[model samples]
Target: MPVTDIITDEKNLTLTVIADFAHPVSRVWRAYADPRQLERFWGPPTYPATFTEWDHRVGGRALYHMNGPAGEKSYARWDFVEIEPERSFTVDDLFTDEHGDPAPGMPVMRMRFAFEATDQGTRMTTTSDFASLEALQTVLEMGVVEGTRLAMGQIDAVLAGLREWFAGKGTRMEVLTDTLVRVTRAIAAPRSVIWRAQTDPVLIRQWMLGPDGWSMTICEVTTEVGRSSHFGWAPDPGVEGEPFGFDDQLLFLDEPFRIVTAGRMTGVEGPTVTNDLTLTEEDGVTLLTTVMEFPDAATRDMILGTGMVDGMEMSYARLENLLLTRPVV
Candidate 1:
């Protein structure tokens, strides 16, 4: 949220976003050069952007699509016009169709990006030039200023090292959008070991239990895509609570790295949420990131209000302890 100035000039037919950050110019520039990092905050928290093609050189165009919570996509193409590493760059940004072709009737905006070093750190200025006042107004009405502010607010987390920023934070949850939420936790375990602890039914039963008073009654796992996994838990002997389970269909599986699933409460009828779980390891610590897409904002809030993150923190802590005492084979 370091935005200092948001300017709209009717005579110039342009809009600009200016922000300052406490980082070197080189470091701030890499955030845009790397697609993996760029996608982290390019769009608003709600509609996350995914780059399908990345070519940063002049005459090359980058293609990306922002995914909406309800399975909608808004595609964009960026044609690089100029490049001066760590100094300045320009691009002709356009709304595009699924095929990356310019969508008819969409106004193309010429964007200039400038980076400069300051006493505190770095400053970034982005200016968008439109063909006419009407074109500028069109994007203004699209909530471009607010969305850019919120998106830029995420730059701090991206600038900090993952371990430095998130370690010891138990569990972190962010409402990305009305129907999408992101959760993250850092585990002091290797990537493969953590993956096995999650997917192996035998290991799962050991630490997947929510709390001290619960026991995993059912631990069914499926490693293959297009399969189903089921998990159930019940109160331990003498404990007072109802048994519950989750039914999940595996849609995508990348061993030791990522998995995507459609999950719903077992025996309960409604919509199935899409969960994308990814693990990245740094310095022997695995960062667990889960992006959950719910059916609606209400459904998202309901589950979060149920102490879901608290339960997850308990399970993750148990998993960490189990890993320490009983190292994976």
Candidate 2:
């Protein structure tokens, strides 16, 4: 577990927290730089934070809201004053309205984050200065310390996820040309296991769900090179609409390592897309890469506009969890 220490100086109207992460500086730095990663640990676990706007450079601003368990939300904003890459950054933090404008009668704080590399890992120190001791005391009464501690405690899990992604063992997305999108991830499962998960309808149904409340209504896979497969997804219950899915013809197959397919999305106006999937094993981990080529940039952009990147990230995350928890027979 990482160690988090909090210190306060009423006279100086400052609160400081020091913590160490068992990850390299770059890996730890990403928790603050990446908006999606920041959302995972920015607030107490119960009140998850979502950033609607994020810009981390100097003079940039961020607008976010923390959603409480009881359908409540607290909006906030940050004005970045300075940023030093993987080293340090300073920001002005303040309470904001739902529209991201600063809230009246709210105390503002200047916060600084410093990161240093150590033999064990990266050490991070955060200091927040209030305009007056009263402001500091007020926030303390609001359980700031404990809430912050709980939030920071989640960094370890984020660091682990980032390590896999950044260490060449996690998913990477690239846009090759205007019509192609490539995604790759490294899994800590055997090639055979991963191959089965891709081709076996039973296993596919477990990891192929689009998002929460979405389920696969149909899944069929044929390992033969000339055969075809089909999969479909239905939205959450009570939704009024037909399910959407895809039908694909397997063009190539290389046992447990490679597969190529040409598929068309059902109930959607789009050109047929070609999918190329490859798997490689190194040590005990297997790396999976997927390439999707569309007929035109317009089609690709239309799909990208539908939060495809975030959806894919969530889907891959669920797959990773499944691989870790499900017993492989």
Candidate 3:
């Protein structure tokens, strides 16, 4: 993993990253501006990755979703803040519920991507700002550094592949997603392990979620509550597959108490749905209840018809079983 500068703050935490590539400014710019290109380079590329809702215009919205390892899933959104063709772009990254409302325990992530011409090609720089020191530390502890490093590497590979294609050697492929998949696991392990699995992006990549053939390129935590983090997962090179994806924002996160989130299906980008997951002790077994509330009749029908809720239940069951069978040593 490439090391990026990790800047600390007494009040505000910030992260700055810079990378140079051997590609023209226009090509580099297209990789960032085009959603289709984005799907190829972002996140865990090995997992099935898709860009469900992409509005690259300024003031527009972008959303994405992906299936995860061990029956885990993820979704997110962003609002474009500024755009300047090939020079710079900015966005306010946040976690929204299914209704597009902000959620708790997540912090606001303001990011700016700048492209500058260089002797070799173009130098791309990314700067991420957080609200406070605690938020920064929280995110660091949650595994932003490693995740970001992996994601940047994938971006580099994508650019390289694009260049090769321009040289008359690569074949272009189309990305697709037929249906949304939700995986649930039932684990008997203590809630602490479960918490680690949920909070730490590293562990999340290990087992939580990844599309069919892609890997998690980036997973960073930006806040504790009412904030949003940035996660990048993309398709692995030469892999053609789709992971069930969603576009959700975290609504509530109470540590081991419960978690609530809302978002829409990533494959179709339809109505939003809210999910409430509660972890309670039942006869020494953790009773995990995941209830998904749809915003409209259409969404409810979609959830039911797709069997995503059932999939979620099965995933939860697997998690519970894993926790129970393996003693937390």
Best by lDDT: 1
lDDT of 1 by residue, 1-329 (tens): 66899999989898988989888999999998988888877877546688999999999989999865434689999999999999998999999999999998878999999999999999999999999888888898998987887677667767776777787798889886787788888888889999998788889999888778999888889977778999999998899999999999987776776788899999999778898887767677888888898989989988999999999999999998999998996
List pairs with backbone clashes in candidate 2. Answer: none
Best by TM-score: 1
CA RMSD, predictions in order: 3.8, 16.5, 20.5
Stretches of candidate 1 off by over 4 Å are 1-12, 43-55, 65-75, 96-101, 132-154, 176-179, 190-193, 222-228, 249-262, 269-274, 281-283, 293-301, 325-329
Positional deviation of residue 58's Cα in model 1 after best superposition, in angstroms: 3.7
Ranking by lDDT: 1, 2, 3
Clashing pairs in 1: none
The lDDT per prediction is 0.86, 0.79, 0.58
lDDT of 3 by residue, 206-318 (tens): 54333345565656653354454445456778888544444456766767745666656455646766555544332233434444555555655555676444444443444
| Candidate 1 positional error at 79, Å | 2.2
For model 2, how does the per-residue alpha-carbon lDDT over 31-83 read when each residue is reduced to its tens digit? 89999888867876445688999987898999999865334689999999999
Model 3 segments more than 4 A misplaced: 1-12, 45-49, 98-100, 162-329
Off by over 4 Å in 2: 162-329
